[model samples]
Target: MKPVRFWVGLVLVALGVLGILDATGALETGGLLSGWWPASLVGLGIVAMLSQRRMSIGPAAVTVIGLILLAGTLDLAEGGLWWPALLAVAGFAVLAGLRREHSTRTPLVMFGGATTREQSRHLRHTDVSAIFGGSTLDLRQARIDEGATVDAFALFGGVKVLVPRGWRISLGGLPFMGGLEDKTDSTGDLPADAPVLAVNGTAIFGGVEVTNTPEK
Candidate 1:
């Protein structure tokens, strides 16, 4: 189900209504919503989790971070706790990522641009990271027997993914002050077990786009 945008829109509308009510003196939302802005992060994290078939680190991290901030804001926990917790989580993620094997390791593009094109007949997994730069992953020539997964991270940068029209794309990720654009053709006629490519990651102040546009 394509419920990502639906839920996001619903939340925004609810917030707007609350604001209007507060402005009209119909509600004392200011007192209720004070320091509650971080709930948006928690909601987005939950939405991301629901969108995916399995658990993912990105959404889990987002949720945890949101909870930490909410606790601090509500005076339920020390404000100093968030920093150490964030660092620990980030360290764990980095170490975990290093242990995984991929067809290509195209991580860390800082202040530049990088492109990785994989033509493996049995492609399995790959990852991309763009920080203050841009990155592209072209899997148009790759053949997947069962499925493949791509982990993408874009911070103050952009990522573009090129895939073949024959493959089914499952896009799941979190976008914070950023966007995730899916330009792939529909797979309405594909079989239930058609070769799938699962793309997941986080875009912070950047964008991650998946396109099936044919090469010139």
Candidate 2:
């Protein structure tokens, strides 16, 4: 994937260079290059596809849209066909997003709100993302696995994670114009074999709060 991204990035850079040369009157094919600027979108879509390890519809849709735009710009396709195809692509992207949200065990909230409370006896890793939204994960009833980690990201939003008592909580993250609070209490006089839960990630213009609560 890294190699693929590198090549795609090179192609984008080459296109940018061509555009710059054309703009400066250094290239004889300046008019053609300027008119065919939609090729840059195709390069961007390729970069997006290669950057992700998992299969995602977002990049695929982007690639398709870029191709359509390129065709339209080159007079290979009618302009009327482009808009309907783009609308269809948008519908498919929404469906794919909903499917991913439903299938994943981890919680992800983007531009919306969600509450996640799984009944697993042993909790492992969980991911949370909140952008212009809020999310809450209640794990008081679940047992924390040793060295479990929570990856969270918030931008103009908030996330709250509630863990059971007696679990050791470690906070390690960066906040840029934001805050990360670990309100969990330490279990004094307890043995050193308690499970550890590490919270790590970033918050920008947002907040994350992790609190300790008694088991149900």
Candidate 3:
């Protein structure tokens, strides 16, 4: 599936074009298209759901709840009923996280600092969390296996990831009152089928930075 931003941009562009045409009296949607504007949320939810390689309950719940809210917004259902459904979806995501088989060997730094440098041939999946502290993860000496994902969470703290050059990287996640930076250099050539390293998660009142480094 394509990136969520791509689909969202396409939707926004289409809406802008339609609005322009309507203003010029070149086309008539009769307000029908305007009434269905909430469909954009539904489209984004679908993109998020399909972007996951494994079936994740979080994305699935988001998709279903988004559709419900979209229906309510379109007057096809009661908008007042959305809250309870949203709460249920949140609970489902929590439960699914607990039941997931993936390793939970997350590196955590609380009120302190930590640095991790693994020499493993293949880095799989990892999670890093920092609260009122800082953490650095160096992967310059490690080989990333295909489909590797690194989930980083920072709250009133900071996290840094140093990746080797020539690695393909994709980023996702949310930043609120904080920032996420990709300072990786793109001067080196990378293969089309190079292993993928996905960096994602949340940064609240904190920051996460990913930078490329020379191989060690």
TM-score of each: 0.56, 0.53, 0.52
Point to the candidate with the largest lDDT.
1
Sliding window of 10 residues with minimal summed lDDT for model 1:
52-61
| lDDT leaderboard ranking | 1, 3, 2
Sequence-dependent TM-score of model 1? 0.56
Give the per-residue lDDT digits (tens) of candidate 2, residues 35-143: 5777765664455445443334423544565678777768766656777667767775675566544333556576788888856666666656666789787877777
List clashing residue pairs in candidate 2: none
* Among all candidates shown, the one with the greatest TM-score: 1
For residues 1-216, write the lDDT of model 3, one tens digit per residue: 345446656887988899888889999865757576667756655665455444344244435656676666577666565766677667655655764456334566778998888565767876666777898888788787676887776767998888888788887676757888888987778888888889985565789888876225
Task: Name every residue pair that clashes in candidate 3.
Answer: none
| TM-score of candidate 3 on Cα atoms, chains taken together | 0.52
Q: How many backbone clashes does candidate 3 have?
A: 0
Q: Which 10-residue span in candidate 2 carries the lowest summed lDDT?
A: 52-61
Q: What is the C-alpha lDDT of each candidate?
A: 0.73, 0.66, 0.69
Give the residue spans of candidate 2 off by over 4 A.
1-104, 213-216
